[model samples]
Target: MAHTAGGTALTPAMKIAIAVIGVLVVAGIVVIAMLNTAGRDGAEAPPSSAPTTAVAPPTTPGPLPGATPTTGSEVPPPTAAPGTGLPPLAAAEPLVAAPLPKSGSRDGGLVAGFPTSVAEPMEDSDVVSTSIATENTAMQVSLVSSTTTALDEIRAHYRALWTSLGLREQPGDDSTMAFTGEFESLTLNVRTTGTGNMYTIFGVLRTE
Candidate 1:
């Protein structure tokens, strides 16, 4: 065998072969040792918990900028009553103030008991009607169709019924005439007032 450096007994081919085998054995042992250690560690260790990712902090809601909260003392609503749609009422007439006055006559021509009187004359185309009223008595006089044309004829008729009866013909004020008369039964006071053509008669008839 040929020795290269010092006084070695091995040949060059043998040294090469020995070095290759030793490298192979060491590589094999290293692989087996690594596998054994991995098995042992894996078996002995407890299961690893998953990495606890840093959890985000719970998000808090922000308050509104200028909002106001309501208090408990709020105003209550109004309640309506029943029967809201009733109709309007009408105006009333006024009452008369004074008691009826005494009849116009003191005699019993128109009435038997009470004194004050008022009267009216109605002249239609063909007929005439007279109405007389007294404070205590009432009388109605009617003039039928007659050919009398003069107002004196009507006045004389009433005067002749009660001889001392006088005629106060009120053409303007509130009446047309206030006739005072005395009949055998009572005294009569007749007041006649006219508006346009229709004549109203108010009377007072009483005892003499």
Candidate 2:
């Protein structure tokens, strides 16, 4: 006599088929769960709103060579030192004395009626010579040549003048002298006396 299994009346082949169907159902559920998890992770988060770095504006190159730029402040003027006073007196007003005569080639180098006694001796190397008008109305009387002979003559002439006038010649300072005379004014005399060339310069200044 054949006996049936206690659990179910299903055949062995049918039971195997049922087990396979049950596994399939479980796998499908697992796949669905995995897909749901992946979807949750894949959804894009709110688009990032953070700001990006900004680029700086371009700088302009300096004005082209020699070309003046229209922009920028001008340089300040230089300051002068304190108490230095204004720039030296411009030759605006004639520094020279006026009332000078236009005749006789009178110039800054020569004066009219200048005394020969105070005139400096003229050097032979100097192309220009000068003199002062003497009491005898001698013009250009102070100039003497650089040569020894001419110099001796000059010394003798002045020596005679001083002697006649009772004036004394100071020993060493050739540039200065004193003469007391009846002349009415101070005079400048320059002499370039020489046999090679004769030239005279004169200047006269009146003393108050």
Best by lDDT: 2
Give a tens-digit lDDT track for model 1, residues 1-208. 4565768787778999999999999999999999999999999999988888797866974445675545643466787776768787444221111343333332212333222222222233222333334443333332223333344544544445433333333333332334443421322232322422222233433332
Q: CA lDDT, every prediction?
A: 0.42, 0.45
Q: What lDDT tens digits, residue by residue, belong to model 2 across residues 54-156?
A: 9876696555678765646356679877776667743322112333323242323444543334444444333344444323222223332233335345455
* Native-to-model Cα distance after best TM-score fit, residue 206 in candidate 1, in Å: 88
Task: State the number of backbone clashes in model 1.
Answer: 32
**What's each prediction's clash count?**
32, 20
Candidate 1: residue 122 Cα off by (Å) = 84
Error of 2 at 177 (Å): 47
Q: In model 1, what lDDT does residue 138 have?
A: 38
Lowest summed lDDT window (length 10), candidate 2: 92-101
